[model samples]
Target: MVGLHLDDIDQRILAELSVDARLSLVTLANRVHLSRNAVKQRMERMERDGVIEGYTLRRGSGPSRRVTAIMLVYRADRMRGAGVVAELARIPEVVRCDILSGEFDLLVTVVAESMDRVGEIWEHVSALPDVENTVTSVSLSRPIDRP
Candidate 1:
């Protein structure tokens, strides 16, 4: 909706929420120099207008770094139903999954604490009923990352 209009206050509210969604309405109101009720009304309007769709969690620095891997999955039946997707969702390590338009049917991104854990997830994916085969590659270094 390119035509959607957002005033300066709405922009400031979005900026603050992007930095820390946990900020209370009172704190946000103070930062935006508006009454608590005013801020609440603006936020509610943004939500209703779909300017603020939802909030997401950002991963914090943990003691152990996570290993990342990409798995290219080949399905036997070409994902006839939602069963395959449902099963993949059950695996927490699977961070992202996308349907591809090539030899592979699905591309899945997985993150785990160690190589062993990544391997375990790979094994689990390989054993899924709909999965015929999977080609996996572990990420050694990320030269560029956005978001």
Candidate 2:
């Protein structure tokens, strides 16, 4: 499926999946206005072409069940140091890490089981060699979360 082109239908399938990867083939097909088999074929082709990668679980944001925190990280060497990013990737609690422009070098998103765990992760991230400073803010509520 190299050099594969994604048509409008394929794009719709991807959009729906991005919102909820756990959607059943039948439900996905219904949302995309395609037959189940056709949708499945397109999904399989997209997977082969690397357009659709692996699926993952999005944990529930139940009160006290999960803690979401964002860390504003300033790197000592800025983007020139890739080591910090590599080390951040090894931490399972680090769900997202984005290199940013301006004041913050990295914006790290962590989802942990508890606030204590998030604090531990913060300590670990702060200890990384190239990490200069970090300011963490725990999320109180999530009104809109769209993938």
Candidate 3:
């Protein structure tokens, strides 16, 4: 969250990518007012510097659905650790998870359809050793971040 210097062009490129991740090099050039080759080089540079994450398609108004949920999993002991988090990340439905503060030690964002599916996922995550308690909250809509 800190120590990152962002120039105007870097900010614009990030904003454009947020709108559409798979934007072609030429399209990016047009949007950023740089040459296609230069845009490609900048993209590669950003990725290498960890400023830009990977690209993925935006799920549209079709049959497919992605349900994002915020989960709080309380462990019996405080040592769930990064290994456990890495294991959870391997689960197909779990988009990401992080160790957090306060009432919950582990916070997770999962993409699953149906309460039934999330219930099933609960079984998988809760069954891990020392996982004593769990709470879940589902997101009804996406929060758009234009930046």
Candidate 4:
């Protein structure tokens, strides 16, 4: 199934899984209006087709538990090269990075164990060859975090 296509049920399954990967087969089937066996078969097919990769646990963030920060990065080469992004990918604390259309070239979200770790990540990112400048802001309170 090199050119495998996903239908509505398949899309729904993926959507539900994205929200909660630990959902039981029966629960997933109920949400998608399918039998448990059918849901299992579809999920298995999706895994074989490379549509469904391995699941990961998303840790929770609370006071004195985790530190989250957003770094706005400006690269010397702008968006011409992927070297900076490749380097950022190696840092496990860097959770999300998005290319923007404003003054900042990339918006990086880092969730580290402590403020000192965030500082270390900031310094590492600042010292990168292609990085021109970076502005970082630590999250005070996550009032509305969807993910």
Candidate 5:
């Protein structure tokens, strides 16, 4: 907590919310020794101050029916701007994308309902204007996963 602006109560609020952002105001208030309205005001203030960015669902920990694949993309233009990123964001199956510094320009994680859908996504990505080549690896099993 050194060099940080958060007080003890604010830190506790963030800590509790990190574990369960859906916690009701009453529960949070009881945990933090505050009224429901006080907790709500603190949360709202934190959100406004950018101390809390936004809540997100942590994936890959629960049971899923989807298949996941990693695609290594070689872009012809080498990510000239946000065009490729904007396009990637449009694809609902593209869970994550990273710019690389090796044989490929981008690494993308695709999750889909079936192998057929994964192939379709691959084709769609390859057809993008900036993409030159791609290599896809399907994840068969994950023995070690942090999330």
Candidate 6:
């Protein structure tokens, strides 16, 4: 199938939505300096093109802080229908999952309020069918997300 061409205005709208998906159409219109109707039309087109799918709230606060834990999940074999990797993707605790190229095939970064929650994930996910092994690493601090 052919893809839609993105002009400068389309790119601007896409970038703004990426940074702050919660922005209302009126707010986005004002920020982009386009008429509300015009902005609405552009946003609608983007949505139809599968560019803007949905909006989400940025959650969490307090000293508890969000924790990022990396998990290495090994499978019985690589071609067992994604095996543990697909199973891990179903977990809400898991935020990011990637197919690694090494001794392990799945690398997952889980976000939670405490280490206990992270451990719970390891216990449950590692015990699933076709899982060979799991190695975990807890992040001390995030240097990139914040200044």
For model 3, the superposed segments whose C-alpha errors exceed 4 Å read 1-63
* Model 5 agreement with the true structure over 8-52: per-residue lDDT tens digits: 577667756755678999998998899999989988887877767
* Per-prediction TM-score: 0.57, 0.59, 0.52, 0.59, 0.57, 0.56
lDDT of candidates 1 onward, in order: 0.80, 0.81, 0.71, 0.84, 0.79, 0.74
TM-score of model 2 (CA atoms): 0.59
In model 2, the Cα lDDT at residue 99 comes to 87
Query: How many residue pairs collide in each prediction?
Result: 0, 0, 0, 0, 0, 0
Q: Tens digit of lDDT per residue, candidate 2, span 1-147? A: 444566557766765665567999999989878899999999888888877779988667663466789999999998796778767755656766788999999998887778999989999989988889999999999999884
Candidate 1 lDDT, tens digit per residue, 17-61?
755678999999998899999999998988898778888886778
Per-residue lDDT, model 4, residue 71, is: 99
**lDDT top scorer:** 4
Error of 2 at 80 (Å): 0.3
RMSD of candidate 2 to true structure, Å:
7.8
lDDT of 2: 0.81
Model 4 TM-score (2 dp)? 0.59
Predicted structure 4: lDDT? 0.84
lDDT string for model 4 (49-111, tens) is: 877778997666743467889999999998899889878755657767789998999999887
- Error in Å for residue 25 of model 1: 12
Colliding pairs, model 5: none
- Pick out the ten consecutive residues of candidate 4 with the lowest summed lDDT: 57-66
Candidate 6 Cα deviation (angstroms), residue 129: 1.6
Q: Which of the two candidates, 3 or 4, achieves a greater TM-score against the reference?
A: 4
